[model samples]
Target: MQETAVNVLHPLKTAALAAMLVLATGWSAVAATPPDQLLVGMNMNNVLTLDPASATGNDVVPVAANLYDYVVELDLHDPTQVRPGIAESWSIADDRRSIVFRIRSGVKFHLGNPLTAEDVAWSLARTLKINRALASPWKAYGFSAANVERSIEATDASTLTIHLPRPTDPRLVLYTLATSIGAVVLDRKTVLAHEHNGDHGAQWLTTHSAGSGAYALARWRPEDVMLLTRFDGYWRGPAKLRAVVLRHIPESQSLRLMIDRNDLDVAMGMSAPDLNALRHDPNVAVETVASGSMYYVALSMSDPKFADRRVREAIRNLIDYDGINRTIMPNYGVFHQRPVQSALPASLPDPGYALNVAAARKLLAEAGFPDGFKTTIRVLADPPFMNIATSLQSTLAQAGIQAEVLSGTGNQVYGAMRNRDFQIVVGRGGGGMEPDPYSNLRALVYNPDNAASAKLTNFQGWRTSFSDPQINRLIERAERERDGAEQIRLYQQVQQRYDADVGPIFPISQMTNTVVLAKDVHGYFVSPAWTTRLRDVYKQR
Candidate 1:
């Protein structure tokens, strides 16, 4: 009665009613609109270098990680897990040496060109050609004289395959390929257009960017500030915030004051003490993530002052990791109780090495350096390690060693360390999407084949002549093993050997960084391994 006979049996009316229902469903399909603005601050100046292959420094990696995307992505929620990013899917040959990948559909570079397999081939070739100055995470996948053949070829527009001389394990694919430094896919046509200008990976991409990432560099000045804006043309949904602004605040106290005043939305590379103070404020939020990195003293193996094993052991024993953690690092980090060979979570047999003065002295005496030698230690001007370095110098002095502490900017410190200009240098090393022992170990151990190997602790240019046949064999086997369990085992063995040898690195601490952001931010995840993914991160209303 209320429906007034319900317009009974009218087919046209029924059709109209159905059409209205369909319209409502379509309306619900619309996506939520993104935010208007997003901002962040940093304690130190970011290099603001856009070239992923050559970008170095703690501040630079966090920014490039989000502004750039790789073909394969390591799952943030699960450090060991991985998913496809630019490439849709991949498969290995029967021998497991060659891999064929089917490019994802609808992917486009920042320049609006569709992504193709030829771009993949070009990207790999570019990385091999440049062999970037920065030690990338991908160098571990057996990128040797043999692996440098640019073995990549595009079978077709969407199909690409890479032929490895030896059968590579499937698990080794992502570990060796998923690097922050190498092969960030670009538009083949855009690169070709610039090829005549002598620009390719790092050298070409430095001032500009052309990846399919969430944002693009809108503006950048080396010593000033850099700006990033959401890529409206992104194949993935547009980022929530309209833009990201990176300020270069070289002074820690100034940065702290800025954040406290609410002038900064987020800050990058905050020191442990300043971070702790921010976390205590009720109005501010602090987020600490385990940085997938390890800081060590790089001994000049080629230097005459540190040439003896006794001297190196003496230096290692002289470091007071426990005291440093209590004072400098405070609540922000753990005393490197375990000798960190590789950053693998489970691979560490123990959290750190014990401070054994007796063992250290014995080793020193055996090497004919019972009276300890005099040397200098170089370090960054940053405060987090200022107290630690001073303590190290004092401890070495007690051992009849003259330890002169020299402070300088990051660039100066890096240059000194690379050229073996100092007897010992305090530095941190870890990068790329995946943290492999190869990444950490290679930096400390010199590999004759690696171009960067000369700068690493293992290089012939450095002091310690420490070598282990078992470790070398394991490194070769680990590179070949595709099976996860076997690979882990091989790495564990490497760790054990490293522990026994107790070479150049006297690893003292593994840091837990507190990262603070506005409550409206989403997709922020930090791994204990110290990996931060900027791609999936966005702001919410």
Candidate 2:
């Protein structure tokens, strides 16, 4: 692969020209990037919005994390541990229906506005009012627009209290506050100042920011570049790097070439092959972290064919789990067949589903499809997804099932899944942002209503049109259970029931994110929740 130069000038010639120009005109060299600025290359195709109440996908997590501050944060090294952020300390009521957080003093937003408990309360209430993608968790906890104002209130200037409308485990709510972007505290005064038509500043916030964090938004051009400048007055102190430049480069080979030419300090979304090639380079270091998400093939039960339990079981048997994990998922993911992530204690082991063409054919015949049928597999036209779809197509063909691969951007693929308009989709999702088992189960398996009019697009279970009353009951019961041992037992039972009923969403692997960075870049911690903060990242000269 040939390196793509940012300009027409060669490195040495550019350096010499810069020196001559500096001597003649008193100007700094433009050929090399400054040590104080961190250059990052990543795929930003899915970053549709910056509004914390509406943004979806992992691409927006890092951006929101730096521009906003959550009340609490999960530890980078140990995600199970929750640490204070804007809130110094918090207490839960004995009834587990309410919790109060004490906001730290002297925190200031980017615009020099004071951060107070009112901002925290209003920020959370705004999510429920807007009822966008991020509001799903809050809604699941039984908080809605009707009761948000009374339920979440500012007891004082520094104390914010949240009263649950329904019974739930307070720990889960605390985890949500720590991990969800919707929970980020916004400057109430600033946001209301920009409010247009009573949107609560949703429109203005898409291109602007109002939060107390280590960095402030400098500039953002969708699908092109995002710039974050350090905030000197940040409560935790200024970030080590003066600025962060994130460039959206989708092609894996182009990212590889840029990294090799010392043009990019970090590269994300590289293919498995590109990652392998860079693994042995002394100038670059590869870092991998286990994300809480999962990679799976979902069968839409809305289709009559997939509605049959026999057909769903047959399709599960047709997947090449071992082959796909060994060949296509080196740095992408690991073999995991359960819905919950492996880090949770309630998670169950893989049920050992493997490719058995004979068994699948028998099951298909029993389902009244003696000669199999034709279908389409919708997938993103990127690494791992496309590779997984291609492998699945070949395996399904072995059982006399003719399958066609339809690949498009993340929007086209996942958008179709969200609308319940796809036959099958190879995608990645789950509620792994929090360490609790309820997070994954709620996102992946619990579906309260199956009507098309319900439009619960955020839940994968509802999107797949797969729901079991028994599984739903178990999941809800587990979430409200206070006893740790009883909760684990209930979660384990839910997984067993899901497997026995042949759920439509088949989990093949647990997702893992890998990034290649320049050796001199230090303190870059890859977070499992996708909330990676650049506050501590520094370049060693």
Give the winner by TM-score.
Answer: 2
- Name the runs in model 1 displaced over 4 angstroms: 1-35, 43-48, 134-150, 167-169, 201-204, 303-307, 331-333, 337-346, 356-370, 430-433, 446-466, 482-486, 527-541
lDDT of candidate 2 at residue 459, scale 0 to 100: 90
TM-score of predicted structure 1: 0.82
Deviation of model 2 at 509, angstroms = 1.1
- Report the C-alpha lDDT of model 2 over 289-348, residue by residue, as the tens digit: 988899999999999999999999999999999999999999999999999999678988
The candidate 1 region of ten consecutive residues with least summed lDDT is 1-10
Superposed by TM-score, candidate 2 places the C-alpha of residue 468 at a distance from the truth, in angstroms, of 1.1
**Count of clashing residue pairs in every prediction:** 29, 0
Per-residue lDDT for 12-117 in model 1, tens only? 2345434433322232232322244445555435464666656655566556655666677676666566678777788877777778888877877776778888
Q: In angstroms, what RMSD does candidate 2 have relative to the true structure? A: 5.6
Q: What are the RMSD figures for all models against the true structure? A: 12.0, 5.6
